[model samples]
Target: MKKLIKLGIALVAIISLNACTEDDGFTFIAKEDPDGLTFANTPSGSYTLTAANADNMAERFVWNAVDFGVQTPVSYELQGAATESFDNITVIPAGNSTNVAVTVSEMMDLAEEAGLDNDPTTAEPNTGIIYFRVRAYVGSNGGNVVDQFSDVISVTVNLPEQSEEEDEDLPKLYVVGNFLSASGYGTDWTATDGVPIAAEAEGNTAYEGFVYMNVDAPQFKILQTNENFDDNYGDAGETDGVYTGILESPGVNAGTPDGTGGYYLVNVDTDALTYELTETSWGVIGNATPTGWDSDTDMTYDSDTQTWSVTLDLTEQEATDNGFKFRANDAWDLNLGDTDADGSLEFAGDNIGVPEDGNYTITLDLSNPRQYKYSISKN
Candidate 1:
């Protein structure tokens, strides 16, 4: 009986050993490594990028590796954007490598996209900052579930100013005329107090603005300065109801637009040496109007106030649907809307907000150039 019991114990021990060796059925759960990544090599100071060193290295971005709980492969990449918020990101693959070397040409492209310009006349600055971050992802996919990102880093880039910038300051002009004195626009309202028609921009030669003239056969002159008439333009061939005219500096006589007199949109070009005037009539159009985007509700022009006024019973649907916009001559060729909803008008901008269903007097004032404004008075 003792020998039989020993044999049975040996058989049980061997069976237990075989069961322990067959533990391959256990599942391994891999949780994303509960850790964050940071820049291991942060570049400091501003870098001046040039075309000469376009092929040279800009900087080397290095980051630490990630262990995704298990031995699962973790892929890394570099992300760059012009904005600090990282909108519109550009991706550069790093594969399994933790470091990425960016060339000077690549950085220049980034700086340019960030609005860095070497031109002195441009509104954009020469130096700007570009943003970057490192992304560590697990497996082959880089989705939100298994992906983690390093803190954003900013690098300042500069473009050297051009030695010779061809563009010079654009010319400016002022409209001086007889209609100004009686209007009480300025203290004197003569050539000295002439309404301005400056260049559209600092480096542009063309000038534009709105002018209110209530004179019969309105006569005027274009002057370079409001202080003096030293540089002035007069009639080369100007006539009433004529939309455009060529002018000669130190001209023979003042410009006589044989107009019945109302508000006119004026445009002057120094390069072309010509002036154009358009008698514009404004209107309102949208889902808010009576025509409901199919047509226009024309507004009447007031010569005294230099405004286009209209009274309409805005639809209830307008308060929920699209609002209205001020367009010229019942056409979308020239339309203005409250882009910022700040009562100021921009071309092809956001639709103006519609008021509650009520009769309101809406005024469109294009008398001010670039500073076009509108008014809404509840009736």
Candidate 2:
């Protein structure tokens, strides 16, 4: 019995010695979190590091446990470079956690101190590439020694280019005008004979009527020329010296047409009064008028006649109230007249109202020599 007991004690001692030797040879290696680490093309302004171990060695190194035979303090160093090869690296201390985060700005300051022109906000450094790795230190009675390095991770920063263009400013203007008779009769009333007369008060005959145009800004100069005109006489009278008289209205088409006229549509180049008319309502002569002319069509310049025309088939009431107006931004009075086979008695003029932006139409009754219609719109 004594011999058996001594043998059991020897066996226990040998087992303990083997365990000690095995524990002393064990090592704690630095590792990376997520097995293999990844970073954004442009990393967040800051980042953190996490150490992991598949062999369950993290607690031994990261937590400074004694199980791994650590006799002294343990510290960590993070190295970064422009290449995964880790050449020309920068080192920073790792705090007391398995993971450590550092600000890109802070890292940039460190780079500057190291004689590198690296802007964390830009990708100008590291030849447009960045890399990171971790090293762990284990201290013993002899001295501190680096255990192992984690796999290197690549990082990239995307920077925006400096060249971009801005939008351009567009030009705009507002105009107003009045429509009055060119005969001695009141603006709203014309001679029963329907003889076309000039606004002047001399020669064959004279009349007192006027129209006005007002623009928001004075940036643009006016250009006026007679598009068409007719005299009641059989022979086509020369437009010799057509002039425009300016007038004002309480509201669009509200002021008395007989009131003394105010501003004239003078030619920009010649200083002569100008007027224009279209042969056929400028292509807006549809059989049926749409629900909203102002919302549907756009006014275009008629190069041939030097006039702008819009056509509408609205009723007399729509024409008088909403259609025909002499207020500001309501009309463009041309120094021209209507001279077609329809005869002098069928002469008509329109007071087109300008809306926001779009197309519109204006209509006229050829049967009646002295009256016409107009519409304004955008598309």
Candidate 3:
């Protein structure tokens, strides 16, 4: 009987020990990492982005859910960078989801931020390769979660050619110093005398305009504003035509044109930190003009109206069924045409035809830009 009683006590003690160790919703066992956390639908080999494709999806990164051997929810993040190691990474929160669709505009923004040039025409390589990876994490609101990363994938990013119309909202630039004077030095550095760089368009940061330079005062500096020297730029060296030029200190060597001083079209790109001074002249070249298609009839600048104007006699032979267009420096490379034969001037649109042959005063008003207007008044 005693032995039986002892056996019964031992069984009760074993049952009590098991009960003490039981857990309702917790354990000390280490959780296994979620499986199948790989990229399911991968990106393409190459992607070409343009203004038209801004709303289109560039890539849809699909991945399997991570199974952390539990019922815990997981969050996935899509990250990208220029470097393969993702040292300079841009993380895009994908929420507690398994897929994320990136738009072309979004990808372009990322590529540019990653040091890829936005210009496709002149940029070396033209196509930038970007690396991407997916990371999955689990926890209560992302607290105390384990991170698992998928294998990296790369995609080639190609940007469309930057249209002149797209660059119509850049900052302004000015021309100061000897370039304005015959002695290679100007007494008045005031805004009135300081040549203003005409903006490419009304709301553009890029600027272009013609300036007369003489050998005596060939040197010049570019300023953001004509009233102050707070923001001005000069040549980094004596080198001319350096596209990637740096802004030198004041009173330093100024930039000169490639050839002897003449009328130059100064083009400045503030965003790219580049400038170009090319000898240029403006003229009308078309069948409808007095000069006809064989030669050009030049337009003179009217400072009062801030436009180019000319008075010419349009004969019947030149005006009848003939159209005209404006050319820069008498070159076809840079010219203006009209579309729908409307007053709205396009870079290379249709021709502006004469309704009737008569003596007229023509004015090309580029003050508002992109909305360039012109009027031909028959006299």
lDDT of each: 0.63, 0.28, 0.57
TM-score of each: 0.49, 0.24, 0.44
Q: Kindly provide the TM-score of model 3 when superposed on the true structure, using C-alpha atoms.
A: 0.44
Top TM-score hit: 1
Candidate 1: tens digits of C-alpha lDDT, residues 1-379: 0000001110000111121123211211111111111111113335666553354345556665665565767787888889989888888888887766666678778888898987766888987799877777776564444666665667666776643232123345777776774544553336777766656567687888777665675667888887788868776754423333787776644543545565667888877888877766789998877888999999987755767889988753322137798998778878887654445577887776543456778888776565677775545
| Backbone atom clashes (below 3 Å) for every candidate | 1, 43, 12
Residues 51-110 of candidate 3 have per-residue lDDT tens digits of 433543445566655555557677778888878988888887889877676656677776
Give the Å shift of residue 367 in candidate 2: 70
lDDT of 3 at 131: 77
Candidate 2 lDDT by residue in tens digits, 3-60? 0000111000011112223443222232232221121212232221111001111111
Error of 3 at 30 (Å): 91
> Once superposed on the true structure, which residue ranges of model 1 sit more than 4 Å away at CA?
1-172, 181-189, 238-244, 253-259, 302-305, 316-321
Better TM-score candidate (2, 3): 3
